[model samples]
Target: MNPTPATSLSALREVLPQLAHPDGSPVRALVVDDEPMLADLVSMGLSLCGWEVRVAHAGRAAVEAARGFVPDVLVLDWMLPELDGIEVLAKVRSFRPGIPALMLTARDSVDDRIRGLAAGGDDYVTKPFSLEEVLIRLHRLVQRTGVMALDADELVVGDLSLNVRTREVSRGGEAIELTTTQFNLLQYLMENPRAVLSKAQILDHVWDYDFGGQANIVELYISYLRKRIDAGRVPMIHTVRGAGYVIRPA
Candidate 1:
């Protein structure tokens, strides 16, 4: 039987019990594909599986949606209009590094997959994929990274402070409201302050097993963290070109 919208929602509801939630917050996802029908199917499948899903038909639009959607995961097609998936992924990495991104493409060549990963994609799914496989992969990815949980005791950086248990962040005694992922990435950076941590290293510590080998994701997330944590304040996180990252007082 073809899965209508109602049937899809019902199926998703049935699987809700098996899926885990992020401490009661809805799991958000962004799907980027030029093919509207394909994007809709993927969105419906994800929605049924208990994800809050949004779709973008082009790379530029995908970036715009991400600012508001703040998606925990991004399902990006390799080929896109205006900007290709790789370009979109690059732009996203500039803004939200460490957010897991799964690439969808009809191109199954090893070179293509390698290019995607090198560009900062966390995972790759070729076209004609099985819904079951995507769901399982996403679950594993989320579980491995633990990106949803924000109940840690505390995060500290050179006298700066973030109490995860209290959801409070302070630099020089001033409080900050960091989104869940930002907090996690910042915490990881603070924990390894002064170490030239690479993007891959950050992704491994911050995202799930489904994270691709691309390093740009780390760069993007660092920018997001810096904007919130260092914009008008002293810089705490610094990027080393051709190397990785280091955290220190500015």
Candidate 2:
């Protein structure tokens, strides 16, 4: 009952990142947690994000909701009355393999993280978490799923643009060429404008690479993107010290 959620809807809206389906529909979200208060809170918070949301209290109910709701993202609690979150995740993913799932739990051990992720959870949130944290994580998860987008064909921030279909990029009406890796990196940055993306996130989404050892690849590609995307223009991409990179209007 002591959930540390954002103080007000205004605060949530101000801090929360905006996401949209390419078709201009609200994001569909499913909340599965046996704790009624927690479930309700998450459902309400997601609704405030302008998402279409459904809540379930148990694993079986979660799967049923997954079928009827056909949610685009899932916030699933690991321990459930009947089937547990891992089982529910598998069942839901059987029909919707590409759906992004964020697992909720009190267990913070490395083993559990590995287990949840191995079982197809796209992200993990420890218990006693804030609604803001969950909201931010959900934004990252949906973006990684390749479903949430600013527009169907292109993502734009100020004059910077990336065409998802044609793989073309431009800034201030000038064509900018990029290599395949650099293009993917810039595309990811453009997709989540104004949101800080960690190097680990960049590797996972842009390269599908493991978060460790090869993180330098992200930095390298980012530098390449800057040289091309920001050359002779006001910079659109920025680095958040100790956090990650974000793209926004100059």
Candidate 3:
């Protein structure tokens, strides 16, 4: 007899331990696709891999979700009803510049892939992709971004100070402690201060991958940093509408 839904859920839970973060937080992902069945399939597969997944059917909805849901990775389709994947990515980058975004599309030409990457895609997966490959790539991206050790040397943006190696952050002389992911994400932003970097660009440089996961991960970490580093303080990380992020002194 086939297992009941509860039994299947329990079985899935048992496997979650193997895929969960060391601290037990569920990895989060967003899926954007115009095709309902394809989006469902992608969400289900990612859920099976222990990701908390959400789906959006249009580019505009995807952008709105990126701001609120703040997923760690985005599985985005190249074509959409209104804005298209490129437009969605551009908008997401404006709010949270360093999120990791994976592009999914039926277009397989080299030029098309280049265009996607140039438009803020960390990675691209063509249609008819293997589920296993997607899982592996996503796993690699999450592990790399979420688990890196930062340098303890101090980083300065005018009077603001951030120590990547020690996970200590401060403005002027006051000190702060940041989560591992937050520290790394902030360090990357500060390191490239004054330069506008999109979420995909951040993922490519900091996470050191071409693609695999949700772009909103950058936004989530940025939120963490804002609370820890910029909250109650003058804003330094500024958003450029329809562009990306730039860190500049107030």
Candidate 4:
């Protein structure tokens, strides 16, 4: 049973609730895929995540969409008619310079991946992929680019600061060592400061929808974050008992 656009979007929201940006606007995305079903599916999923998505089935259409849509991220398919993915990426970057793009292809070779990155893609995904993987990668790209930021390079809660550009975390002017996962988790929490986010919400943003391991993984990571970000400090990260966690200046 194939899902209709409405149903697909609804399922996506059930798994990963889509919250509006801090500024109350949807993040915009440009999805370029030749296959109608795949493109529609991806678009619907993104839309469910509060992203304003525009679909382009061809390389030329993708380039055109970038001009008008001005998306924060671009999900491009490698094989396309009228200018391959690489060429389309080149043109888009020429004007939009540094706009993050995730290239999707059936090409799984190391050399192919390198070429895609060298040709101006921030990330690459091979076909037979999970929609969750795509969404996660897109989130990472957006975070790294500060696409959701409200015109700021730093997100601060209390004395803690997460530098969107340098990818640095510091509390009370002291550098805090964090792994990539820890950094991402902390960033998510700090981005929505004072908001009580549920465990499911944390997992959806920090981990993936298909995380088949222990359900305590979110708790484990929260502990990991506390150790680094809250251990010796004033403890900005707090457990809300029945609710999830929230980062607020204590």
Off by over 4 Å in 2: 1-9, 148-250
lDDT of 2 by residue, 4-87 (tens): 545666687765546675456788999999989888998888888788899999989889989988898989999999999999
lDDT of 4: 0.79
In terms of lDDT, which candidate is stronger, 1 or 3?
1
As for TM-score, the candidate ahead, 2 or 4, is 2
lDDT of 4 by residue, 81-133 (tens): 99898998899988898778999888889999999998888899998777777
- Candidate 2: lDDT of 213? 96
* Alpha-carbon deviation at 181 in model 2, angstroms: 21
| Model 2: ten consecutive residues of lowest lDDT | 143-152
Question: Each prediction's Cα lDDT score?
Answer: 0.74, 0.81, 0.73, 0.79
Positional deviation of residue 98's Cα in model 4 after best superposition, in angstroms = 0.4
Best by lDDT: 2
lDDT of 3 by residue, 1-250 (tens): 1212445545544543233332446777889999898888778767765579899999889999989998878889988988899898889888887778889899899999999998888888998776655666776555434322122365566457666556677776788787666777778887665678888887887677665675777677767777877788887777787677777654
What would the TM-score be for candidate 2 when compared with the true structure? 0.61
TM-score of every candidate relative to the true structure: 0.54, 0.61, 0.53, 0.57
Which lDDT value does model 1 have at 91?
A: 83
